[model samples]
Target chain A: MHKTLWREIKKEKNYLLAGKPVPRLLILNAGSRNHLIRCFLKSWAEQGEIIVSDSYPLAPSLYEDCRSFIIPFYKHKNYTEAILDLCEKQKVTGVLSLIDPDLSILSELKTEFASAGILAFISEEWIVKATFDKWEMFKVFEANHIPTVKSWADLSEFLNDVKNGKAGYPIMVKPREGSGSRGLHYIESEETLISVWNNAIEPMLIQRWIEGRELGADLYFDIYSGELIEFFIKEKLKMRAGETDKSVSLRDEKAENLLKRLSRNLALYGPIDVDLFITAHDDYLISEINPRFGGGYPHAYACEADYPGLILQNMQGKHLTEQKIKWQSGHYMMKFFDMVFIDDKTRRNAGEEIKQQEEN
Target chain B: MHKTLWREIKKEKNYLLAGKPVPRLLILNAGSRNHLIRCFLKSWAEQGEIIVSDSYPLAPSLYEDCRSFIIPFYKHKNYTEAILDLCEKQKVTGVLSLIDPDLSILSELKTEFASAGILAFISEEWIVKATFDKWEMFKVFEANHIPTVKSWADLSEFLNDVKNGKAGYPIMVKPREGSGSRGLHYIESEETLISVWNNAIEPMLIQRWIEGRELGADLYFDIYSGELIEFFIKEKLKMRAGETDKSVSLRDEKAENLLKRLSRNLALYGPIDVDLFITAHDDYLISEINPRFGGGYPHAYACEADYPGLILQNMQGKHLTEQKIKWQSGHYMMKFFDMVFIDDKTRRNAGEEIKQQEEN
Candidate 1:
């Protein structure tokens, strides 16, 4: 859906306010073509120019009406240098890294970007690491008395917990650091659990299953003011490819209070997406956090919860007002497929254009 | 999705006002089981009790936590008598019909229900007939100068138009009185048009194909004041079986002004569903209208457009204000499939329960 909807927003030109010229924004690894990326393109375009980068020259991001650059992957030795070069060339005032692997790297290089007078919209290094590692997040939740699904790193410990009547069967065996339901298995019997554990990946966790409705909370914190500016909650109605395919925006006091508390405790700098479950007894249990915009961010954006505006304001050295978070409830979002056609000749021409830029 | 969400609405009960007791409402042909029905069930239940009826005892309507009844089809000899008897027994104060075929029948029987002190929330007979008959509706649109796709009832006339460069190829051959795309076809050549015309049902029309973004408008007229109280427009991004599968709510002054003119011209009482197409040249064309709740009603409801509340107020002898029409824009709705399961034994038991009630 993020494949260059330049025509859709042409009528929106008249609504843009003529403020001080804002600098370009750099969005890293922006070629996956998701709904959240499309929303941000629409929201941020009204404020300032946007620059997107991916590893492939023929990526969808290249087709958008913005500055595009092909850079090395996050694991590459020159990846950080390539991004800094792109930011300098484009005069980027703010840098946002979307994918998971780059969040920690961007957090570590925040100081470098800051030295060049470019604001990095990322959390602190410790917050990024704690949120990405499930075991570390579990410890943080326990310390804050926030209920989370119990887990065991060893099969013997899980069995002992089962024997002690503290946990039950139908538990999940999942990778310690994974997204999109990779290496996830549910086991109900001892024989199945043993077989799965034997073939399981290293650094896996066996977690107790919470049999209830799943919820996602999209929140944001002002890096300068340390105030929670955005808090939107939605109930996940359906899942596909380990992402929320359908969801409904709603108001829940208990869930809202929990997210506010989490914001105060974590002090996350930029956008935050948290996954949790509401048990049969009406208990809110924190499960995980994604430091960037999650798959369900479009639902929040459609409700007029403007996170992109906040990011632009922060880049301009302004605090986001609470008035920006006023949003509607009862909105149900159902996701579907859309397409963009590019002839082979056009793609090859685009590739040649990028090749000339690279050579220059 | 609305299979007795008792826990989700537990917090809403305190907001109910203890005024005069609201009587039970009867919804006819309630087995389609869409999001609008679920919303109405939730909305009306807060004001008073709800009773649903369908031809099948095992319909999805029976599974909802409300009074249920099995009735004969609309064409049955005793259909009117059956509804009247049910209203008398249940002390029903309001009745709403959801299907296309029953709207005219309900409109015809409006006077009978009025005599019995039961309000039938349907438009007048002339309005119902005009909306259902495409040829008549087209004439009405032409009289008002609201653009509509050119159509022809005579094959020779259509061929002459095409030959004279008045129209182009790829026209639509559809049944003159069809719904849900039952006999819809796109003909690009002379031979294909001939073949489709041979197989089409009698009294068919050749409609000009519009290549543009389609929009659905969910509207309501206050029965008490004869005023257009609610209007919500959505750009239909996807459709299934003539139903809006994915849509985004927005405001368009061109479309809104057209709808307002239509409301004043038609003086439509109760709820209305209008379909239009925004042409490639940025022209709005009136397509069709259904005098009952259309498939996209849930999107308006989710935006807090409160059509059900307006209907309830009308039934309660109160006038709806302009404040009820205020709603949020940019709300997106994505519809998907959900299931409500009932075992063989439970279904049989429900059937038996209905049979006992019928015998009584």
Candidate 2:
């Protein structure tokens, strides 16, 4: 790790000597199991050190040759100013966010970074809001003539529409700002819809049930040239708690074309993980658009596509060349396993239970 | 101005009394145009005190209400720490950039702000670069499937394409990173293209010229909802060096829809000034996208649309319910006039020439 850091520092000094600016990328909310952030930090650490706050204690993977600082998490008024001071002190050239809630904060911080000639990746506030909201994403899809499952803002409105044949039974109901699938449910009858509506919030959307299995595509685009450089599509073979547990990559030309058309219509520039349902009629309807890095992003990394590297290049005002995905062509599974230290008594009880079961 | 300041302060106090968070915006720059800075200070002084460096003389408009300090512009290593100290002292809640180069600096400052839960507007470094480069903008358009005039990276490449019938004459040439069309030229043939390219050190792009009168639209969108709240479209009646000399607001449904679509596709939020060319064949192609406040933004203000106010609302995380725009429908122009304070001899010579012309 020390050797890597020394080599990176030497490379940066060489670039500086050649009059080429080397951008220092700062990662906020650094501790995550997501492969995108890990790969991003690893690649970036090879170029320059990343400054991370002390809040992230578990994931030491990102600490390899990178500097870490203990700082308060987002909730204080001084946070933005503190970051500006850090960038100035360290000569940080860029900033990146690996989580969702931090997107808005990143957007706001971009302006401050700009005054000092540093770079940050944040969209306009409204665009960030629209892309974050499920209902708003649908509105943009509708406006751009992109096909999507029929959706409504309120459950009552959805019920009325379904009763009047505007929507159908077996509709999907979920919260407007929920993560995972904790509150999501499939309703097959009027009674279920009424029950769900009574408990749900005022601004929830109801959409038609997509018939086929779930699939996802991770795509990156050049904001200036509107060129699609890398794409990875995977079919979810299994899932646990709304997170992909196992998936298989498929080379479907139709899906690729659909993604192209959707991105073209939306003029998206950054990383986009789109969820689609291939229906009974062989049509694809977008279920959701995650504009930032998604949970199963490691799957893309496993396929040999470094999304964070591409993003870093874009931030430095460099054009991206075509990068081919060396996809691992087989099923991959991720299991969430936990370990706890057990007392001797508990261990004996567990052994006894196992012996009893074996005897039976 | 004093009266307005007092009233705003009283209003802000009332808001604070009612348990509402008083919105505070921070500006980071090395001081430009005293009049413009004073305008912002006057407005802010009504609600909150202005903060600036003490090295520069305080503008008369902000003398009493503004707070000035001593700080280095970009030389400090611990700039983020210094900003945090300032924020702690002033209790700031938001930030804004008063200059172009400051955008990147602001972006880097977002990380600290995110940790503190404050809001900002500058885009991240990647987004800023994509929007700032004209050639990259075209690439993004193509990647997103938005139709734009044909463009090439260099004059030689453009000429070769033209020879092969891949391109045509009467092209538009400009520096990829130029502002206000300083090095922009309308090339009638290869001769002019070569001449313009040879004279400029900046990288250039040659685009097929869309022959028509220029039009610009300044629009703001609800980032969360992807809804257009305020829009202003106008025809450029006169221009001096790339700055609009005169313009008149016009209502065209087609143009309005096109702008809205473009904004959604780009996931654009905040202030966007789009330059367009409506071809003789009635096709509209994007000339450029400025992801910041334009010189003629005040025209939107005159039309009863408070764009800056919308930005403030988004910063405060407040939803916009009703925003109306009122057009006066008459010709309006902003002429760029120059003034020179010179010695007696030069002034006398210029005065005589003006007097002679007037007499004749």
Candidate 3:
């Protein structure tokens, strides 16, 4: 918290602008994010490079046509050290993660990472932690008058709302800190609600069920100005595994304004994806904000959102201009399955011992 | 259905023996099955050819480096005629569907398909329809003394069993004809059971909850012998979107015998995928049977099960000898995503009209 240390860290964050002609972006826990990694590689074509690090040696992205190596599991004692070493050795200028918990972990190590001249593309520590809890996030949105769905963490509050006819049955009950549709339930009546509440082993958050279209937004902001540069919106047509499987890009003034308001209230950094549901009244009720790249980022990249390119320019100390991003409005993104193959003889060149122990 | 037609169909099934050098294998509804199709193409390199057919032009498999075209949707009045016409034109000797409902549809048109010198690899029509209903399938299993999961379709029957202390709480409620986890609920109390039952729009089947390891078996039977040829077993390490994401090949004698018993109870032909649950007592309870290729089939292919090669050999009039399929055990199969780029101008050459109408 010293003033001198703060100044030094800020200077180191823009280290690439000093002299480096190319930037190496490290994607950690790059598990099946081959699509996102490919987008980075395509934009960085001959000027820069992309490096992937995952605890598992067989992560599909590791075997991609790029420099990849294994790192200790995120929970390991030497996890931070492994990343610091990789960044230093590979000359990585900016790093990002694909997992949620790792957002706070990476942000909390700002001093360590900044001192090494590597910028971790994550929000502040408290902001990242706040996004993890649904109840806390709902309160944050309500406090700022941001549009969000009605939620209740207390059983009595939910029952009182029902008694006063403020809410009705056919609601959602899910873990307070859940993601990707796991541990989520749809209660059609009071009987199911009571039974689910009594049988819960963890704190459950309840919300009014919205029967409308779901939207996923990928927002890109300027590093220095902290101004929204591009907001790519997509209407999720179908979902598989709680992730967007098929979507079509669109431009909605109402949704864009809500996202801008969210940015003003949170002061979040670059490249965050948000989930929202539009009611019949056309109100965009924000559900959650993932302060990291989501699975649907590729859709934006496919539509020429150019987020990776913009981030690289920012790391190079380039001031981005606000422009009318001319993205295609009716393009559809359809996702499918693909795979790679490797044998036992072809194994990791780094962190082999650590990976094996953690995998067991 | 006549004796003369039956005799003529039997003769036409062996049409490959009439001096045809390379037999063509057709895979219908080949959506995102690039992995499985690649296996077939690899084995048929110079000896045979692999053809793909689907109703949608943008199907990822249709864009692969192989002969692909779109047909009418399976529900079309000329669906069977279209497949027959394609088989006659492309010299396709063997045809197989990758969907459950299409099995009976293709098999019912046996005379038409056989007349075109194409053998559809599906079980008899009755058997394929039997697998669609969970309650009926359970009764079939019980009558045949096959090891299967206990199911209750009638609410009064379930209640009587509960009163008799034969059933307990923490059960499962799902659609009677469901597959792959949709509409499935884990009920922990009577209140939830009654509530979920009352709100059901369709018949929901109840089942005893089993806390055990889930396994997926890719069974390949001989075309002529009607005997199990190769049973590729994989323990599902993780699941995504109701499909196996990561699995490891394994050998379990108890489970193999149960699969063998299932083959006897139902004379399924060629390739079939079955799901099983292993209890603490090591009892392999058969859950459901998908009478077609499954998503986890690539795991079997990666382990060198070589079902595609075997099926091709059968089509070429080469009788396969019973041998121990030496697929490597303990090998892990992890799946990831990859994609291809196609602009609007590079649209499908065939079935574009049909595809657009259906997509709308």
Candidate No. with top TM-score: 3
lDDT (Cα, tens digit) per residue for candidate 3, span A1-360: 112334324435644665663677889999988888888879876555677778787687776667677887799888887788777766787888988768988889866777877777777677788899999999999998998999999998999999999999889999998888889899999889999999999999999989899999998777666677888998897786677777778788888888878654586777899998998877789999998887888888887888888888877667877657677566666677876555544443434634543454
- Writing each residue's lDDT as its tens digit, candidate 1 over A115-169 gives 9989888888887998877888888788888778888878898888889998789
Q: What is the C-alpha lDDT of each candidate?
A: 0.74, 0.62, 0.78
Candidate 1, B1-360: lDDT as tens digits? 334446224423432347443655788887645455567667776666667788765456566676567777778898878878887766788888888888888889988888987888888788788787677778778887878888887888988988999978889988878877878888899899988887765778889889999999988887766678888998887775566766777688899888888755675777789898999989899899898887668778877777877777787788875554565555666553333334445556656654665676
- The number of the candidate with the highest DockQ is 3
For each candidate in turn, the interface RMSD (Å) is 13.4, 33.4, 2.7
Q: Quote the RMSD, in angstroms, for model 1.
A: 16.5
lDDT of 1 at B167: 78
Cα error, residue A344 of model 2, in Å, equals: 26
In order of appearance, the predictions have TM-scores of 0.50, 0.44, 0.76
- TM-score ranking, high to low: 3, 1, 2
